[model samples]
Target: MNKVKVLVCGDVEGKFQTLFSRVENINKGHGVFDLLLCVGNFFGDTDEGLEPYRNGKLTVPIPTYILGPCSAVQVALYPHISGCELCPNLTYLGKRGLFTSSSGLKLAYVSGIEAESDTLSHHTFTDKDIESVKNACLRGQTNFRGVDILITSSWPKDIMLGDKGCSVQIEPNGSWLLSWLAAQVKPHYHFSGQEGVYFERAPYRNHSFSGSTPEHATRFIALAKVGNTLKHKWLYAFSLAPIDQMSTTHLYQETTDQTDCPYTGKMLHPSLSMKQVRPSQFFYDMDSLTDEGNQRKKARKDNKQQHKRQPPKFDQESCWFCLASATVEKHLVISVGSESYLALAKGGMVPDHVLILPVGHHQSLSTLPDAVEEEIEKYPLRTSALKKYFKKQHKVPVFFERNYKTSHLQIQTVPIPHNMAGRLKRVFQENAEQDGLQLDELPHHTKLSQVAPPRTPYFYVELPSGDKLYHRVANNFPLQFGREVLASEELLDMADRADWRDCKATKEKETELAKAFRCAFEPFDFTL
Candidate 1:
């Protein structure tokens, strides 16, 4: 088998070890992964740390990509784009987007970069920069209005090195080159699940993982650092391999009797240890319930009444599925209307599928009643069945995918294999924990958005012509505890017509930000 080499590096306090163990489990499950490597940072920057993985104790060679900072494994994995050809942006990594964790709380550390050069200059990427990236990820966001790409271009402000300066120190005793290379060498393993302390499967198949438990903290990994030097700086990379890859192919599924566990059925009890458990409940209170429930109920009732009053006229704009039936054909390409969007289809096939949409906009399945939900679900199946009957008689997959905070209609391309679509769904569902699923439900009322009580209260005034002017509310008004809403129409109260008191301040702030972004993009015409 062609082996997959994963190199991981970052800050010491970050979850490198946990990532290693999880990758190991994935390798065991799929039996196609080889070598595990971890770069230094065991103690982070503290004076009291030791090398965790040392030379000669490793099972195989794996590379590590190093960086100055580290967040949790979920934030780390968020950078990866799947190798599947269906990836919409496989040709290029899109502009860096904000990455928030499942929680509404913005992490204080996450930063996102929008331009290519932004990843290169230390002046642009400071400790504060890293913090911004971490904050974005912690808030369960992947992209912001202006930010689309995420990466580390330069070291912290304390590091002194330049891209051109790196070439001069390539010879012997090149400490600068080694140090700089070391930062770039931190190769993170990007799996679909949470970090674990041990391995149970391979990268080619599903696997279970666990985090470091109190019982395993004392356990140490053997590691050795290799260095390269560039002029005036040190660039280095480290190598670490799992010491136990050969022992069991089944990982946590290993039974006391020493047999490989089946990948499916009763035998597959996720050997995930207790420490890796994540919360899996949805909590809501009366205020939110009242707001959401009433709106959804009203929409549904209106939809039903409209259908009864009309002669069953099909409106493609309201529902994507209806749109597909109205405007699409048997074997053509299809795309949804979500932001950060792309169209998808099978290789060498004509794009002939149309995505189905509801007669009215509904953000998620949870917002729909049982009947509407069922109708929505039928969109995929019906598309697949129709395509099979009229075209190749092949069962194509229907993906139910969407991004958070996007009003753009979610797109769905048809004529793709149902199995592949199913696989994608499984991949998402199975890896939900690792992907930090369900963490963004804090609702805007949370304390995370407490910006020193608004300096000016919002106001409203009526003009002689009966026109109303309103003061802008805070940009980020608390939605619920730990949750917030942007000063956007989605959360507006038209009747109140309150003046957006902070509009001028917010506009000035945005202007300043635009200047900064323009400055960052000055040398290069990124608009091209």
Candidate 2:
């Protein structure tokens, strides 16, 4: 119930008196607001406009945070390259990183604009700037349930994705970097400027969210430059109860204006300049598929077979999920086998959502040693220890695996309420049909080897009815499609809980969870 009041403004353009005067009046009317955020061009064409604050002639009213300057002249005004307080109550958020408030409001920001080249300057942000924000979400040290807010200088392209009634006056010439960043961070709210337009898109569900749509949908707002002659509204105000503090009912309440996500495929996120995109390291790997590359591949598919793409080299030392890696969340590991191990999934979709991983560096189920595959599928109960582990808790196991764009193989097993078993196939089928995909049902108790040969890129789901469904991923497959179906209204109805990154518990809580599972799954632990 920790509610924090926030006020956000568009480009200030160095109109100190006009912006602060309005802010002071609002503070007088509302008495006290927790913080103020300024986005876009904070400085204008002259140093004279900023001199009031430098000379103590103007005050910042509330705790104000601003992105780095937009022009070369403004850059000279900023003394600290790593972010620091310019004066009392005003702080610069630096080049890029995650900023957490005392009230537990997490804000991820990329300052300035998208850099065109590999330049090391604040006027524009490059791939490393955006990647730093992604790397900031590293787990194990602390638990995160997504950021409360995200700030950027420019609106993400197609920011009006789900908003059908988008105004013609406001053309969204935003950044693909911001679009890609928005999809990954999944912040509750996002604010930007730079187009000099005041428009708020209808709350749209982030790519990984489905069931409790309103709880996790991101509200994107772009405020106009302050004191523009056209009289566009450049200020917005809202109150937020941090995600970690809200109760389930309050957080998941459905909103009437929700829309499907606008970001999908490479058209929404065309590749920018980068040395390489390591699809193996990230979960939603789409960098490999450029708009041009996809078209060429499709054209070749019609004429003749396109040569198989050589899989990217797997880097074990930096792998986050590897048990021996320095970055692995060791607290989540439960049971270890010679060939395979059971670990509590980080940011799991459910309390019992777990991962079945090979101890060695196997990239997919097709590449596993025959003996190891046999042990995984044909243990003591003629089933997996994963299946037995969930059954002890009176939940049916729903196992899924993706081989499209990953370096390490992980079989995600999420437990379902016992009664929900019968509804699984129908729901999965309906979702696939909606996506124009047909799920090929394998024969009863079909083995993985029968459906997928060595090094085949496929995604398959094993339902609780002992029935299996498979999808051969040729091109443009949705990364979180399985999660979308499972968390849809017909099945678990946990759309809000679809993304694993939003479901992580505390480290101490995770340790206790592993210990409990290790005890209950002992009988099924063939490793023991």
Best by TM-score: 2
Q: List the global CA lDDT of all models.
A: 0.25, 0.71
lDDT of 1 by residue, 286-355 (tens): 0111123345566768888784322122243432223344432222222222211122211211223233
State, as a TM-score between 0 and 1, how close model 1 is to the true structure.
0.27
lDDT of 2 by residue, 150-229 (tens): 99988887777668878847566678888877876778899998889888888886664344433367888889999989
Q: What is the TM-score of each candidate against the true structure?
A: 0.27, 0.53
Query: Which 10 successive residues of model 1 have the least lDDT summed?
Result: 213-222
**Per-candidate total of colliding backbone pairs:** 138, 4
Q: Assess the local accuracy of residue 1 in candidate 1 as a C-alpha lDDT between 0 and 100.
A: 17
Report how far off residue 32 is in candidate 2 (Å): 17
